[model samples]
Target: MDVFPLPLARIGIIGGGQLGRMMAKAAKRLGCTCVVLDPTPGSPASQVAGHQILGDYHDPSKLRELAEICDVITFDIEDIDTETLAQLEQEGHRFHPSPRVLALIQDKLTQKQAFAAAGIPTAPFVELSEPSPEAFAAFGYPLVQKARRGGYDGRGVSIVKTPEDYDAHLPVPSLLERFVPAAKELAVVVARARDGECRCYPVVEMCFRSGENVLDLLLAPANIPSSVAEAAVDLAVRTVEMLDGVGIFGVELFLTETGELLVNEVAPRTHNSGHHTIEANVTDQFEQHLRAVVGLPLGVTDQLSPAAMINLLGAPGRRGRPIIKGMAEALAIPGVCLHLYGKATSAPFRKMGHVTVLDPDIETAKRKAERVRDLIEISAEDHP
Candidate 1:
């Protein structure tokens, strides 16, 4: 393990989900330890972290306690008490990406506005102060409605194809964005150090699960033309530079049929899109994030191989302790790496884990990934 020769050794993580779990694992490899703050006992991250502080992430007292216990703090999820974090930062507590960035990103409308203000290319959008049917009708149809806060993994977003779909619109303060007819959805994970050093991973293509809006599959070094891919990397790097954040960010984007690229959203921490880097890159995103936050020099992000990754979602209509099926068979495939988050329960479409397939050729890796995907099933032991 590579020990940091600095005072910021003990890391505090908020929102102990799978992201936190993976981050903790990376920290261990770097000769560092993590303290996770989460309300659930034995949460995925808590299962591997050095210690767990059982408390809600939103509680100001719990947030303060976490800051007091560790040298520096970061978060796995975006839904956090930024007000408290800002105050703590004022008092000399270190929080990467800054509480200011988190506060702006917590609201979807503000994020879009910031992108526009920065001259970043994105689909035209407008805030809906009152998301009533009448208001939605005025905005026109075939638009996307996203809640201002507290949305993740396909929740808190609605696609309205017609006036009839307004019944399903998100009722909270939201934004209406003209849905760009995308030729391909892509993502680029960028890491920025406090000293203004920045690096971008190869632009990767993302395939989302229909109706859920969750990432279904990811292909590294996206199969687009070389020029397109370069443009994407440049755009993503510029977007992160604009934020001036000191950590990893996942910038989701849209590629229109006419070959136009537009920014969709930006995630300020380690993100699902970068999960494939664990086995495919010279430096994984988790370790890179730790490096950026702890004042270490960023590592190289060279792709070791073309890779394909798929999320392992829980079986539909199941709810109970998780019972993984077909693991033995799936592991039989060469170049397949399976990761099961120590989640105790299974629910419809819940992310249980992910599988990554690395191969010299991207197409071959994708084929093997599909085979492994079909061979495994995550079901609930106590449910039908």
Candidate 2:
């Protein structure tokens, strides 16, 4: 559908994090107003939004309030009260991706089951209602445990590498799967229109921090063989096609030593793995999400440049007002674009901002991104 006569409707966002912030900006670019509902007084999205409602995402009253004035609502958080959203939808409030989609994806175990039912390639996994010696033994050592709900940004995942950690690291009720000895972790961001037309970005390679699940570098058009990249894209497209997705979806995959691609996870909203799209792609993920939600034709997912992105996490020991050091040095490098989330406080490993480095080649972009990562330090000092 053509969006020439786009409505100036109000877009309601449930969580006011950086993703919401960027999405709001994209909405504004298309002449739409954005309202945020978040508990944080001055969240990242609220800083940019025209109006904000201070309330919890799970509160039914807040959900109603957001639906009352907004044309359509979307959530940045996966933990929103789906029952409430369903009720609101029944009451004539519109929501992109729908409550049913959220219900299916809210649980890690169920998501994996869906992948299996759809005949998608994914790692073997099982639900562990309660961790036991027998259950641990069945899963074997060196397994992965993930919280069924409320997990994001490396918070609800653990790697049990030995028998000693089986009981200690296991969550109360979690999903256990065989640990993947991945040769590379790749991702593809795909946008699906309401009519089911889909387009996917080139595969991206994510480099995690040492011994941490957090991503340090996200490189686009993953430096891999053509066949591997094609496999990653195919898996991603198939994964999204299997879902009732009407917006942007992030499909994360693990490329094994034998070059087999397996689904790792999926994010319904705009994801960290696609942040470089803002500077490198013809249509950024944020704008693509807006297009998909607004019933407009999906934008081209073509890569405009070879790019690499580095997340600027707060210093491990620092906590206070955030102070970004060595900005001049980082900005001095050409083709560098820095984006700082308007977060007031800093904590260990907290995502404060990110920089995207674009160059003629992936190797050059990676090198430039490394320089920006080292030059700038996310630190904080004592303050009120």
Candidate 3:
């Protein structure tokens, strides 16, 4: 293999959330500078990035400004105005995964349609031109309604298990999917270089928060049959390869009780599920994404240790400057790595940060992760 020289690059990130913050940090390690664009002046990514361009994701002028100053651009969000990005790309600006892919993935229904057209295995779904209780009943009970666009962190999804649940259905263009009684939720982060070289991280199992539908805990190298793990990875790799996208892709999968694996969704950027990779993998997803976008060789995706990670969400009823407690106690535990996002305020269940526990044994790692999860509390400083 010819030695690929690292280029001194300026990477522009579209969203200034925790994902972008971590991606900016990884770029810094590669001797690259990052400028983040977000509406919030002091957004989480802006706290650590070289600079931030304060603007909305859909602002065409701001997008152009970001493109002019940076060698390549990527997004931590899926809701950006892809039309502006597509125009920028035509004007010689580079975007990882391309604006076309983002446009498709931004609309949940369109994404599913493409997947189905490509012969991908996914849960049965239908586009709801008119999502009425009658229509929902016709489709059958126990359905998952996902907004076609701009849904994230469990905000734009609703579960209509029966006629009574129709009152809670999302009042927007959406798709109704048959709720799979999944035995487990798994994710694989795949990194694809500009030249089509691809690598997949070990399969990680996801456990969502009750009622919130947000990722709560994750276990790396998901405890499952070796054959199942292999099948999961294969499906994930194939999914990314099919997209033909550069940069890291997170493929969320549903493992049915009958031994079938289905693709739940795909994120075109580095994802929350791969957070433990920062401590356990030979190459973290953020750095891998940077390498792919900057035309460098994709890094090794080997897991160096079994790991578990838990999200630290804001306490339910606290909404002010975040007051994190038990950091000292949590840090004292062996193999505990904590990351706090610099958000100015906390809201109920808002993603504040995360903790990753690494141990020789997955079970031990999970126990330590849960212990850390309980030890830490994120509340408002003003809370009485």
Candidate 4:
């Protein structure tokens, strides 16, 4: 299908975080205007958006106002109440990826069920009334208990390694899943248009911090066998098709020691793992998402270089404002690009920003990314 040119439309984004900021920037590049609805005045997206609507996500009046002003509505965060989106849809407002998709993916239990219903393979899981002894016994030891909703970036997730740990944090309803002994973690970013056209970026291998779910490094065009990479991309494509997605979809996977693949989770937006595409791919994930959501034909997902992305998290004891040190030294490295989210405050383990390093070889990019990560520091006193 040919690209549908909607006349100079204004898009309304629900969250004003860094993702929204980047998405808005991409929209601007495509000759569209963005109006961000966020409670905070100085949000990252608001900083770049032409208009800002200050209101809560659940406020119908605010949503109606946004619907009236914008031609299409989308979201940066999935935590918003889907009921409100559904209500807006009833009034002829357009929402990309639709409210039904958001409702299915917002809760871990619901997401898992949807995956199963779609015939997608995922780790075995059981919905528990509470993370109690009985729940642990049912799922077995060394399981992961995840909150049904509102979890991201290593929060609302816990590993129940033993009975004692399970007993310690009981009485909360959670989803218990058998923990796969993953040899490596991989992720694929897939983009789909409203007309069913889709494309998937090269698979990325993710390295996590020890004993934590936080990603430390992401290497694109994963250093794996061709079959494994193909399988990962296939899974991502099938998952997005099942969701009837109309924008970027991130599929996180676990590659087991026996070379089996299991779906870990999915994010219905441009993801952190795909951030390297901004500097390394012909068409970045942010731009592809805009194209998909706005009924434009999806862009090519070809890689321009072997890239590595290292997340710059706020260090321990860092508070107040952030001071990035050695940025000059880091930028001195060839093919290194630093991107810091314009956040004013820093807290331990908070995702301040990321740096993407591109090179002819993956190993060289990885080493350069590590050096760049070491050079950047977040001090408490330096305000944005």
Better of 1 and 2 by lDDT: 1
Candidate lDDT scores, in order, read: 0.92, 0.89, 0.93, 0.86
The better candidate by lDDT, 2 or 4, is 2
The reply for model 2, stretches above 4 Å from the true place, is: 1-7
Please give me the total number of clashing residue pairs in predicted model 2.
0
Query: Could you arrange the candidates by TM-score from highest to lowest?
Result: 3, 1, 2, 4
Local accuracy of candidate 4 as per-residue lDDT tens digits, 1-384 = 555464456889998888988888888888788999888878888888868999887787888899888888988888887898898899899998799998889888999999888889899998887555775876688888888888898877887788877654535677888878899999999999998988999999999876557999999889999999999999889998999968898899999999998899998888988999998998999889988877777889899999999988888777888877888999999999888888778888788889999999999999999988888887676454
Better of 2 and 3 by TM-score: 3
Candidate 3 runs further than 4 Å off = 1-7, 382-384
Q: Model 4, residue 68: displacement in angstroms?
A: 1.6
| Model 4 bad stretches (over 4 Å) | 1-7, 167-171, 382-384
lDDT by residue for model 3 (1-384), tens: 555345479999999999999999999899889999999989999898959999999999999999999999999999898999999999999999899988888999988998898888999999987778788988998999999988998989998888987899988999999999999999999898998888999899999997999999999989999999999988888888878888999999999999899999999999999999999999999999999999877889899999999999999988998999999999999999999999989999999999999999999999999999999999997744
lDDT of 2 at 256: 94
Worst 10 residues of 3 by lDDT: 1-10
TM-score of each: 0.97, 0.97, 0.97, 0.96
- In candidate 1, residue 316 scores what lDDT? 89
RMSD score of candidate 1 (Å) = 1.9
The stretch of ten residues in a row with the least summed lDDT in candidate 2 is 1-10
Q: lDDT tens digits, residues 192-308, model 2?
A: 888989889899999999755799999988989998888788888888888877888889999999889999999888999999999899999999998889787788888989999
